[model samples]
Target: MSGKTISELTNEELLDKRKKAKNANIISAVLIGFFVGIAVFSAIKKGLGFFTFFPLIFVFMLMRNQSEAKELDKEIKSRNLHF
Candidate 1:
Protein backbone atom coordinates (compact mmCIF):
# COMPACT_ATOMS: atom_id res chain seq x y z
CA MET A 1 0.00 0.00 0.00
CA SER A 2 2.98 2.28 0.47
CA GLY A 3 5.25 2.15 -2.54
CA LYS A 4 4.42 -1.48 -3.35
CA THR A 5 1.36 -2.98 -5.00
CA ILE A 6 -0.15 -6.30 -3.92
CA SER A 7 1.58 -8.06 -6.79
CA GLU A 8 4.90 -6.55 -5.82
CA LEU A 9 4.87 -7.95 -2.31
CA THR A 10 6.63 -11.19 -1.41
CA ASN A 11 4.54 -14.07 -0.16
CA GLU A 12 5.55 -13.54 3.47
CA GLU A 13 4.96 -9.82 3.19
CA LEU A 14 1.64 -10.42 1.50
CA LEU A 15 0.51 -12.73 4.27
CA ASP A 16 1.64 -10.27 6.91
CA LYS A 17 -0.12 -7.41 5.21
CA ARG A 18 -3.25 -9.50 4.75
CA LYS A 19 -3.26 -10.37 8.46
CA LYS A 20 -2.88 -6.74 9.40
CA ALA A 21 -5.61 -5.75 6.98
CA LYS A 22 -7.99 -8.31 8.42
CA ASN A 23 -7.22 -7.20 11.97
CA ALA A 24 -7.76 -3.56 11.00
CA ASN A 25 -11.09 -4.53 9.43
CA ILE A 26 -12.24 -6.12 12.68
CA ILE A 27 -11.10 -3.17 14.77
CA SER A 28 -12.69 -0.70 12.37
CA ALA A 29 -15.99 -2.54 12.44
CA VAL A 30 -16.01 -2.53 16.25
CA LEU A 31 -15.15 1.16 16.38
CA ILE A 32 -17.82 2.02 13.84
CA GLY A 33 -20.41 0.21 15.96
CA PHE A 34 -19.16 1.89 19.13
CA PHE A 35 -19.14 5.34 17.57
CA VAL A 36 -22.62 4.75 16.17
CA GLY A 37 -23.90 3.88 19.62
CA ILE A 38 -22.28 7.02 20.97
CA ALA A 39 -23.74 9.07 18.16
CA VAL A 40 -27.20 7.70 18.89
CA PHE A 41 -26.82 8.36 22.59
CA SER A 42 -25.56 11.88 21.99
CA ALA A 43 -28.34 12.59 19.54
CA ILE A 44 -30.92 11.42 22.08
CA LYS A 45 -29.34 13.46 24.87
CA LYS A 46 -28.77 16.66 22.92
CA GLY A 47 -28.62 17.23 19.16
CA LEU A 48 -26.47 16.24 16.17
CA GLY A 49 -22.86 17.41 16.13
CA PHE A 50 -19.33 16.04 15.63
CA PHE A 51 -20.24 12.62 16.98
CA THR A 52 -22.76 12.22 14.17
CA PHE A 53 -20.02 12.53 11.56
CA PHE A 54 -17.29 10.65 13.46
CA PRO A 55 -18.66 7.20 12.72
CA LEU A 56 -18.66 7.96 9.02
CA ILE A 57 -14.87 8.17 9.09
CA PHE A 58 -14.67 4.71 10.62
CA VAL A 59 -17.14 3.42 8.07
CA PHE A 60 -14.84 4.67 5.32
CA MET A 61 -11.86 2.96 6.94
CA LEU A 62 -13.76 -0.32 7.27
CA MET A 63 -14.68 -0.15 3.60
CA ARG A 64 -11.12 0.63 2.58
CA ASN A 65 -9.76 -2.27 4.62
CA GLN A 66 -12.28 -4.64 3.09
CA SER A 67 -11.21 -3.55 -0.35
CA GLU A 68 -7.53 -4.01 0.45
CA ALA A 69 -8.21 -7.45 1.95
CA LYS A 70 -10.08 -8.53 -1.15
CA GLU A 71 -7.25 -7.36 -3.36
CA LEU A 72 -4.74 -9.21 -1.22
CA ASP A 73 -6.86 -12.36 -1.31
CA LYS A 74 -6.99 -12.21 -5.07
CA GLU A 75 -3.24 -11.79 -5.28
CA ILE A 76 -2.67 -14.64 -2.90
CA LYS A 77 -4.99 -16.89 -4.82
CA SER A 78 -3.40 -15.98 -8.12
CA ARG A 79 0.02 -16.78 -6.69
CA ASN A 80 -1.26 -19.96 -5.00
CA LEU A 81 0.05 -18.75 -1.67
CA HIS A 82 -1.26 -20.52 1.44
CA PHE A 83 -0.85 -20.50 5.18
Candidate 2:
Protein backbone atom coordinates (compact mmCIF):
# COMPACT_ATOMS: atom_id res chain seq x y z
CA MET A 1 0.00 0.00 0.00
CA SER A 2 1.19 3.50 -0.81
CA GLY A 3 0.55 5.16 2.56
CA LYS A 4 1.99 8.30 1.01
CA THR A 5 -0.54 11.07 1.45
CA ILE A 6 0.48 12.46 -1.97
CA SER A 7 2.82 14.90 -0.21
CA GLU A 8 5.16 12.57 1.66
CA LEU A 9 6.38 10.12 -0.97
CA THR A 10 9.91 10.34 -2.39
CA ASN A 11 10.76 10.42 -6.08
CA GLU A 12 11.20 6.65 -6.39
CA GLU A 13 7.85 5.92 -4.77
CA LEU A 14 6.09 8.43 -6.96
CA LEU A 15 7.67 6.92 -10.03
CA ASP A 16 6.53 3.48 -8.95
CA LYS A 17 2.97 4.68 -8.55
CA ARG A 18 3.09 6.25 -12.00
CA LYS A 19 4.32 2.99 -13.45
CA LYS A 20 1.51 1.03 -11.83
CA ALA A 21 -1.08 3.51 -13.02
CA LYS A 22 0.24 3.34 -16.56
CA ASN A 23 0.07 -0.43 -16.53
CA ALA A 24 -3.50 -0.30 -15.35
CA ASN A 25 -4.31 2.10 -18.16
CA ILE A 26 -2.87 -0.26 -20.71
CA ILE A 27 -4.92 -3.15 -19.37
CA SER A 28 -8.07 -1.06 -19.34
CA ALA A 29 -7.53 0.01 -22.94
CA VAL A 30 -7.09 -3.56 -24.10
CA LEU A 31 -10.23 -4.82 -22.37
CA ILE A 32 -12.32 -1.86 -23.43
CA GLY A 33 -11.14 -2.18 -27.00
CA PHE A 34 -12.20 -5.78 -27.16
CA PHE A 35 -15.67 -5.14 -25.80
CA VAL A 36 -16.14 -2.01 -27.88
CA GLY A 37 -15.10 -3.80 -31.02
CA ILE A 38 -17.77 -6.40 -30.42
CA ALA A 39 -20.40 -3.78 -29.81
CA VAL A 40 -19.45 -1.73 -32.87
CA PHE A 41 -19.45 -4.78 -35.06
CA SER A 42 -22.90 -5.78 -33.85
CA ALA A 43 -24.16 -2.28 -34.51
CA ILE A 44 -22.66 -2.21 -37.96
CA LYS A 45 -24.46 -5.41 -38.85
CA LYS A 46 -27.69 -3.51 -38.29
CA GLY A 47 -26.63 -0.75 -40.75
CA LEU A 48 -26.07 1.73 -37.95
CA GLY A 49 -23.20 4.24 -37.93
CA PHE A 50 -24.45 6.03 -34.86
CA PHE A 51 -22.05 4.67 -32.34
CA THR A 52 -19.17 6.50 -30.63
CA PHE A 53 -18.93 5.10 -27.17
CA PHE A 54 -15.56 3.35 -27.45
CA PRO A 55 -13.64 6.39 -28.66
CA LEU A 56 -15.10 8.44 -25.87
CA ILE A 57 -14.22 5.81 -23.31
CA PHE A 58 -10.70 5.51 -24.67
CA VAL A 59 -10.17 9.26 -24.53
CA PHE A 60 -11.50 9.42 -20.99
CA MET A 61 -9.22 6.64 -19.84
CA LEU A 62 -6.22 8.19 -21.61
CA MET A 63 -6.90 11.50 -19.96
CA ARG A 64 -7.00 9.87 -16.56
CA ASN A 65 -3.71 8.11 -17.34
CA GLN A 66 -2.05 11.38 -18.29
CA SER A 67 -3.43 13.11 -15.24
CA GLU A 68 -1.94 10.49 -12.99
CA ALA A 69 1.44 10.78 -14.68
CA LYS A 70 1.38 14.57 -14.42
CA GLU A 71 0.46 14.48 -10.76
CA LEU A 72 3.36 12.16 -10.02
CA ASP A 73 5.69 14.38 -12.00
CA LYS A 74 4.59 17.45 -10.10
CA GLU A 75 5.01 15.77 -6.77
CA ILE A 76 8.47 14.44 -7.59
CA LYS A 77 9.67 17.78 -8.92
CA SER A 78 8.42 19.68 -5.92
CA ARG A 79 11.02 18.02 -3.69
CA ASN A 80 13.77 20.42 -4.85
CA LEU A 81 16.51 17.84 -4.54
CA HIS A 82 20.01 19.36 -4.63
CA PHE A 83 22.30 16.35 -4.82
Candidate 3:
Protein backbone atom coordinates (compact mmCIF):
# COMPACT_ATOMS: atom_id res chain seq x y z
CA MET A 1 0.00 0.00 0.00
CA SER A 2 2.97 2.28 0.64
CA GLY A 3 4.27 2.42 -2.89
CA LYS A 4 4.28 4.73 -5.87
CA THR A 5 1.20 6.69 -6.83
CA ILE A 6 -0.68 5.80 -10.01
CA SER A 7 0.88 8.68 -11.87
CA GLU A 8 4.39 7.84 -10.68
CA LEU A 9 4.27 4.21 -11.73
CA THR A 10 5.54 3.14 -15.14
CA ASN A 11 3.25 1.29 -17.52
CA GLU A 12 5.11 -1.95 -16.84
CA GLU A 13 4.78 -1.45 -13.10
CA LEU A 14 1.09 -0.76 -13.43
CA LEU A 15 0.60 -3.86 -15.55
CA ASP A 16 2.49 -5.95 -13.03
CA LYS A 17 0.46 -4.57 -10.17
CA ARG A 18 -2.76 -5.20 -12.07
CA LYS A 19 -1.73 -8.79 -12.79
CA LYS A 20 -0.88 -9.38 -9.12
CA ALA A 21 -4.14 -7.87 -8.02
CA LYS A 22 -6.07 -10.05 -10.46
CA ASN A 23 -4.32 -13.16 -9.17
CA ALA A 24 -4.98 -12.15 -5.57
CA ASN A 25 -8.65 -11.61 -6.37
CA ILE A 26 -8.95 -15.06 -7.93
CA ILE A 27 -7.20 -16.74 -5.01
CA SER A 28 -9.25 -14.85 -2.46
CA ALA A 29 -12.50 -15.76 -4.22
CA VAL A 30 -11.59 -19.43 -4.25
CA LEU A 31 -10.67 -19.32 -0.56
CA ILE A 32 -13.88 -17.51 0.25
CA GLY A 33 -15.85 -20.22 -1.54
CA PHE A 34 -14.02 -22.91 0.37
CA PHE A 35 -14.61 -21.16 3.68
CA VAL A 36 -18.26 -20.61 2.84
CA GLY A 37 -18.61 -24.32 2.20
CA ILE A 38 -17.00 -25.10 5.53
CA ALA A 39 -19.18 -22.56 7.28
CA VAL A 40 -22.33 -24.02 5.74
CA PHE A 41 -21.28 -27.50 6.69
CA SER A 42 -20.57 -26.45 10.25
CA ALA A 43 -23.82 -24.55 10.50
CA ILE A 44 -25.78 -27.54 9.24
CA LYS A 45 -24.00 -30.00 11.48
CA LYS A 46 -24.13 -27.90 14.60
CA GLY A 47 -26.32 -25.20 16.14
CA LEU A 48 -24.22 -22.38 14.64
CA GLY A 49 -22.59 -21.00 17.76
CA PHE A 50 -18.89 -20.69 18.57
CA PHE A 51 -17.68 -23.21 15.98
CA THR A 52 -18.56 -21.00 13.04
CA PHE A 53 -16.27 -18.22 14.13
CA PHE A 54 -13.15 -19.70 12.53
CA PRO A 55 -14.63 -19.97 9.06
CA LEU A 56 -16.24 -16.60 9.46
CA ILE A 57 -12.86 -15.06 10.21
CA PHE A 58 -11.37 -16.64 7.12
CA VAL A 59 -14.29 -15.40 5.04
CA PHE A 60 -13.72 -11.91 6.35
CA MET A 61 -10.03 -12.04 5.48
CA LEU A 62 -10.81 -13.24 1.97
CA MET A 63 -13.38 -10.52 1.57
CA ARG A 64 -10.87 -7.89 2.66
CA ASN A 65 -8.35 -9.15 0.12
CA GLN A 66 -11.00 -9.10 -2.57
CA SER A 67 -11.85 -5.52 -1.74
CA GLU A 68 -8.18 -4.53 -1.87
CA ALA A 69 -7.86 -6.17 -5.27
CA LYS A 70 -10.90 -4.29 -6.46
CA GLU A 71 -9.33 -1.02 -5.31
CA LEU A 72 -6.18 -1.87 -7.22
CA ASP A 73 -8.23 -2.63 -10.29
CA LYS A 74 -9.94 0.75 -9.98
CA GLU A 75 -6.57 2.47 -9.73
CA ILE A 76 -5.32 0.67 -12.81
CA LYS A 77 -8.47 1.51 -14.70
CA SER A 78 -8.29 5.14 -13.68
CA ARG A 79 -4.81 5.25 -15.16
CA ASN A 80 -6.14 3.69 -18.38
CA LEU A 81 -3.75 0.78 -18.16
CA HIS A 82 -4.93 -2.33 -19.99
CA PHE A 83 -3.47 -5.57 -18.79
Candidate 4:
Protein backbone atom coordinates (compact mmCIF):
# COMPACT_ATOMS: atom_id res chain seq x y z
CA MET A 1 0.00 0.00 0.00
CA SER A 2 1.03 3.60 -0.62
CA GLY A 3 0.97 5.41 2.69
CA LYS A 4 3.20 7.89 4.44
CA THR A 5 5.61 6.36 6.85
CA ILE A 6 6.47 8.16 10.08
CA SER A 7 9.31 10.01 8.42
CA GLU A 8 7.18 11.01 5.45
CA LEU A 9 4.50 12.72 7.52
CA THR A 10 4.59 16.45 8.17
CA ASN A 11 6.13 17.64 11.43
CA GLU A 12 2.81 18.17 13.15
CA GLU A 13 1.45 14.85 11.94
CA LEU A 14 4.65 13.11 12.94
CA LEU A 15 4.51 14.51 16.43
CA ASP A 16 0.86 13.65 16.78
CA LYS A 17 1.44 10.14 15.52
CA ARG A 18 4.34 9.68 17.86
CA LYS A 19 2.28 10.80 20.82
CA LYS A 20 -0.54 8.47 19.92
CA ALA A 21 1.80 5.55 19.30
CA LYS A 22 3.59 6.14 22.56
CA ASN A 23 0.39 6.28 24.52
CA ALA A 24 -1.01 3.19 22.87
CA ASN A 25 2.24 1.31 23.32
CA ILE A 26 2.35 2.21 26.98
CA ILE A 27 -1.25 1.14 27.49
CA SER A 28 -0.66 -2.16 25.76
CA ALA A 29 2.44 -2.82 27.79
CA VAL A 30 0.56 -2.07 30.97
CA LEU A 31 -2.23 -4.40 29.98
CA ILE A 32 0.23 -7.13 29.17
CA GLY A 33 1.81 -6.67 32.55
CA PHE A 34 -1.57 -6.80 34.23
CA PHE A 35 -2.36 -10.06 32.57
CA VAL A 36 1.08 -11.38 33.33
CA GLY A 37 0.67 -10.40 36.96
CA ILE A 38 -2.57 -12.26 37.09
CA ALA A 39 -1.10 -15.31 35.47
CA VAL A 40 1.94 -15.28 37.73
CA PHE A 41 -0.16 -14.80 40.83
CA SER A 42 -2.33 -17.65 39.75
CA ALA A 43 0.77 -19.80 39.62
CA ILE A 44 2.40 -19.16 42.97
CA LYS A 45 3.59 -15.59 42.39
CA LYS A 46 3.42 -12.35 44.34
CA GLY A 47 1.71 -9.06 43.65
CA LEU A 48 3.61 -6.10 42.21
CA GLY A 49 2.97 -2.90 40.31
CA PHE A 50 6.02 -3.02 38.05
CA PHE A 51 3.94 -2.81 34.93
CA THR A 52 2.58 0.58 35.97
CA PHE A 53 5.98 2.04 35.33
CA PHE A 54 5.50 1.88 31.57
CA PRO A 55 2.81 4.56 31.53
CA LEU A 56 4.84 6.95 33.65
CA ILE A 57 7.97 6.52 31.56
CA PHE A 58 5.96 6.85 28.38
CA VAL A 59 4.35 10.12 29.48
CA PHE A 60 7.69 11.72 30.19
CA MET A 61 9.26 10.52 26.97
CA LEU A 62 6.25 11.47 24.90
CA MET A 63 6.22 14.99 26.32
CA ARG A 64 9.87 15.48 25.61
CA ASN A 65 9.64 14.05 22.10
CA GLN A 66 6.62 16.16 21.28
CA SER A 67 8.27 19.33 22.53
CA GLU A 68 11.39 18.63 20.53
CA ALA A 69 9.38 17.88 17.43
CA LYS A 70 7.50 21.14 17.78
CA GLU A 71 10.71 23.08 18.19
CA LEU A 72 12.21 21.44 15.15
CA ASP A 73 9.12 22.12 13.11
CA LYS A 74 9.16 25.76 14.18
CA GLU A 75 12.78 26.08 13.21
CA ILE A 76 12.18 24.54 9.80
CA LYS A 77 9.17 26.74 9.12
CA SER A 78 11.08 29.82 10.19
CA ARG A 79 13.93 29.00 7.87
CA ASN A 80 11.53 28.35 5.01
CA LEU A 81 9.54 31.53 5.64
CA HIS A 82 9.52 33.91 2.68
CA PHE A 83 9.76 37.59 3.40
Candidate 5:
Protein backbone atom coordinates (compact mmCIF):
# COMPACT_ATOMS: atom_id res chain seq x y z
CA MET A 1 0.00 0.00 0.00
CA SER A 2 1.08 3.56 -0.70
CA GLY A 3 0.97 6.59 1.55
CA LYS A 4 -1.29 8.35 -0.92
CA THR A 5 -5.06 8.08 -0.73
CA ILE A 6 -7.03 6.57 -3.56
CA SER A 7 -7.86 9.97 -4.99
CA GLU A 8 -4.24 11.02 -4.88
CA LEU A 9 -2.82 8.00 -6.62
CA THR A 10 -1.79 8.28 -10.26
CA ASN A 11 -3.57 6.17 -12.83
CA GLU A 12 -0.81 3.55 -12.75
CA GLU A 13 -0.81 3.46 -8.98
CA LEU A 14 -4.56 3.31 -8.94
CA LEU A 15 -4.53 0.36 -11.29
CA ASP A 16 -1.92 -1.39 -9.19
CA LYS A 17 -3.78 -0.77 -6.02
CA ARG A 18 -6.99 -2.02 -7.57
CA LYS A 19 -5.25 -5.23 -8.58
CA LYS A 20 -3.99 -5.71 -5.05
CA ALA A 21 -7.43 -5.01 -3.66
CA LYS A 22 -8.95 -7.60 -5.97
CA ASN A 23 -6.39 -10.16 -4.85
CA ALA A 24 -7.03 -9.32 -1.22
CA ASN A 25 -10.77 -9.59 -1.73
CA ILE A 26 -10.31 -12.98 -3.34
CA ILE A 27 -8.22 -14.14 -0.41
CA SER A 28 -10.76 -12.79 2.02
CA ALA A 29 -13.54 -14.65 0.28
CA VAL A 30 -11.59 -17.89 0.45
CA LEU A 31 -10.91 -17.40 4.13
CA ILE A 32 -14.55 -16.63 4.79
CA GLY A 33 -15.61 -19.80 3.09
CA PHE A 34 -13.07 -21.80 5.03
CA PHE A 35 -14.11 -20.25 8.33
CA VAL A 36 -17.78 -20.82 7.60
CA GLY A 37 -17.06 -24.45 6.89
CA ILE A 38 -15.21 -24.76 10.17
CA ALA A 39 -18.00 -23.01 12.02
CA VAL A 40 -20.59 -25.36 10.61
CA PHE A 41 -18.58 -28.48 11.36
CA SER A 42 -17.76 -27.29 14.84
CA ALA A 43 -21.34 -26.45 15.55
CA ILE A 44 -22.50 -29.90 14.48
CA LYS A 45 -19.99 -31.65 16.68
CA LYS A 46 -19.63 -29.38 19.72
CA GLY A 47 -22.66 -27.11 19.77
CA LEU A 48 -22.29 -23.34 19.63
CA GLY A 49 -18.85 -22.12 20.63
CA PHE A 50 -15.97 -19.87 19.60
CA PHE A 51 -15.50 -21.53 16.25
CA THR A 52 -19.13 -20.94 15.37
CA PHE A 53 -18.79 -17.20 15.84
CA PHE A 54 -15.31 -16.72 14.38
CA PRO A 55 -16.61 -16.55 10.84
CA LEU A 56 -18.59 -13.40 11.62
CA ILE A 57 -15.40 -11.36 11.83
CA PHE A 58 -14.20 -12.63 8.44
CA VAL A 59 -17.64 -11.97 6.96
CA PHE A 60 -17.38 -8.38 8.13
CA MET A 61 -13.95 -8.04 6.62
CA LEU A 62 -15.18 -9.49 3.34
CA MET A 63 -18.00 -6.94 3.24
CA ARG A 64 -15.60 -4.11 3.91
CA ASN A 65 -13.26 -5.37 1.19
CA GLN A 66 -16.15 -5.52 -1.26
CA SER A 67 -17.08 -1.94 -0.42
CA GLU A 68 -13.51 -0.88 -0.98
CA ALA A 69 -13.51 -2.59 -4.37
CA LYS A 70 -16.69 -0.74 -5.26
CA GLU A 71 -15.07 2.53 -4.26
CA LEU A 72 -12.10 1.73 -6.47
CA ASP A 73 -14.47 0.98 -9.33
CA LYS A 74 -16.21 4.31 -8.80
CA GLU A 75 -12.92 6.13 -8.80
CA ILE A 76 -11.85 4.41 -11.99
CA LYS A 77 -15.14 5.27 -13.62
CA SER A 78 -14.89 8.86 -12.45
CA ARG A 79 -11.56 9.10 -14.23
CA ASN A 80 -13.10 7.64 -17.38
CA LEU A 81 -10.70 4.73 -17.22
CA HIS A 82 -11.49 1.20 -18.26
CA PHE A 83 -10.17 -1.87 -16.56
Candidate 6:
Protein backbone atom coordinates (compact mmCIF):
# COMPACT_ATOMS: atom_id res chain seq x y z
CA MET A 1 0.00 0.00 0.00
CA SER A 2 1.09 3.60 -0.57
CA GLY A 3 1.84 5.95 2.31
CA LYS A 4 -0.51 8.58 0.86
CA THR A 5 -3.94 8.73 2.42
CA ILE A 6 -7.11 8.55 0.35
CA SER A 7 -7.89 12.14 1.35
CA GLU A 8 -4.84 13.26 -0.58
CA LEU A 9 -6.24 11.95 -3.86
CA THR A 10 -8.31 14.05 -6.27
CA ASN A 11 -11.79 12.84 -7.15
CA GLU A 12 -10.67 11.60 -10.54
CA GLU A 13 -7.70 9.82 -9.02
CA LEU A 14 -9.90 8.25 -6.39
CA LEU A 15 -12.40 7.06 -8.99
CA ASP A 16 -9.65 5.63 -11.14
CA LYS A 17 -8.11 3.82 -8.21
CA ARG A 18 -11.51 2.47 -7.21
CA LYS A 19 -12.15 1.22 -10.75
CA LYS A 20 -8.79 -0.48 -10.92
CA ALA A 21 -9.29 -2.07 -7.54
CA LYS A 22 -12.69 -3.38 -8.63
CA ASN A 23 -11.20 -4.76 -11.85
CA ALA A 24 -8.41 -6.43 -9.92
CA ASN A 25 -10.94 -8.01 -7.58
CA ILE A 26 -12.95 -9.30 -10.52
CA ILE A 27 -9.89 -10.75 -12.19
CA SER A 28 -8.78 -12.35 -8.98
CA ALA A 29 -12.17 -14.02 -8.59
CA VAL A 30 -12.02 -15.38 -12.12
CA LEU A 31 -8.52 -16.68 -11.61
CA ILE A 32 -9.58 -18.32 -8.38
CA GLY A 33 -12.40 -20.11 -10.15
CA PHE A 34 -10.06 -21.24 -12.90
CA PHE A 35 -7.50 -22.50 -10.41
CA VAL A 36 -10.16 -24.33 -8.43
CA GLY A 37 -11.43 -26.00 -11.57
CA ILE A 38 -7.93 -27.14 -12.45
CA ALA A 39 -7.33 -28.38 -8.93
CA VAL A 40 -10.50 -30.42 -9.07
CA PHE A 41 -9.51 -31.93 -12.39
CA SER A 42 -6.06 -32.68 -11.08
CA ALA A 43 -7.50 -34.34 -8.02
CA ILE A 44 -9.71 -36.50 -10.16
CA LYS A 45 -6.90 -37.58 -12.49
CA LYS A 46 -4.03 -37.65 -9.99
CA GLY A 47 -4.05 -38.00 -6.26
CA LEU A 48 -3.97 -34.82 -4.19
CA GLY A 49 -0.61 -33.54 -3.04
CA PHE A 50 1.27 -30.41 -4.16
CA PHE A 51 -1.35 -29.78 -6.81
CA THR A 52 -3.83 -28.84 -4.10
CA PHE A 53 -1.66 -25.95 -2.99
CA PHE A 54 -2.21 -23.94 -6.16
CA PRO A 55 -5.90 -23.42 -5.49
CA LEU A 56 -5.19 -22.49 -1.88
CA ILE A 57 -2.73 -19.88 -3.07
CA PHE A 58 -5.32 -18.50 -5.48
CA VAL A 59 -7.87 -18.41 -2.66
CA PHE A 60 -5.49 -16.39 -0.49
CA MET A 61 -4.82 -14.02 -3.38
CA LEU A 62 -8.54 -13.64 -3.95
CA MET A 63 -9.03 -12.76 -0.29
CA ARG A 64 -6.25 -10.17 -0.44
CA ASN A 65 -7.69 -8.51 -3.53
CA GLN A 66 -11.14 -8.54 -1.94
CA SER A 67 -9.76 -6.78 1.12
CA GLU A 68 -8.09 -4.19 -1.10
CA ALA A 69 -11.39 -3.59 -2.91
CA LYS A 70 -13.13 -3.23 0.44
CA GLU A 71 -10.57 -0.66 1.56
CA LEU A 72 -11.11 1.33 -1.62
CA ASP A 73 -14.86 1.13 -1.07
CA LYS A 74 -14.41 2.47 2.44
CA GLU A 75 -12.39 5.40 1.18
CA ILE A 76 -14.95 6.19 -1.49
CA LYS A 77 -17.76 5.99 1.04
CA SER A 78 -15.98 8.18 3.60
CA ARG A 79 -15.66 10.92 1.01
CA ASN A 80 -19.18 10.42 -0.30
CA LEU A 81 -17.63 9.95 -3.69
CA HIS A 82 -19.34 8.77 -6.89
CA PHE A 83 -17.93 7.87 -10.23
Highest lDDT scorer: 5
Q: What tens-digit string does per-residue lDDT give for candidate 2 at 1-83?
A: 45656677766666677678778778877867776776677577754444545455665665565666566667767776322
Computed on alpha carbons, the lDDT of every model, listed in order, comes to: 0.82, 0.65, 0.76, 0.54, 0.84, 0.79
Q: lDDT score, residue 39, model 6?
A: 87
Q: Return the candidate ranking by TM-score, descending.
A: 5, 6, 3, 1, 2, 4
**TM-score winner, 1 or 3:** 3
Residue 10 CA displacement from its true place in model 2, Å: 1.6
Which candidate gets the maximum TM-score versus the true structure?
5
Tens digits of lDDT, candidate 1, 1-83: 48998889989999999889878878877887887788788788878888777776777766765777889899999999884
State the TM-score for model 4: 0.46
> What are the models' TM-scores?
0.72, 0.54, 0.79, 0.46, 0.82, 0.80
RMSD of 3: 2.2
Residue 83 alpha-carbon offset, candidate 6, angstroms: 3.2
Off by over 4 Å in 5: none
Better of 2 and 6 by lDDT: 6
Against the true structure, candidate 1 reaches a TM-score of: 0.72
> Judged by lDDT against the true structure, how good is candidate 5?
0.84
- Two-way lDDT contest, 3 vs 6, winner: 6
TM-score, candidate number 5: 0.82
Candidate 2 shows a clash count of: 0
What RMSD does model 2 have?
4.6
How well is each residue in 1-83 modelled by candidate 6, as lDDT tens digits?
A: 27777778777888998888878877877888898888888888897978866787868867865776677778889889885
- Residue-wise lDDT of candidate 4 within 1-83, one digit each (tens)? 14864345665665565466557666766765666555556555434455444445555554454554454455446546321
Q: Which residue pairs in candidate 6 have backbone atoms (N, alpha carbon, C) closer than 3 angstroms, thus clashing?
A: none
* Runs in model 1 lying further than 4 Å from the true structure: 47-50
Which residue pairs of candidate 3 clash? none
Which tens-of-lDDT digit does each residue in 22-81 have in candidate 3? 887778888889888888888889968766678889888777666655666777788777
Clashing pairs in 1: none
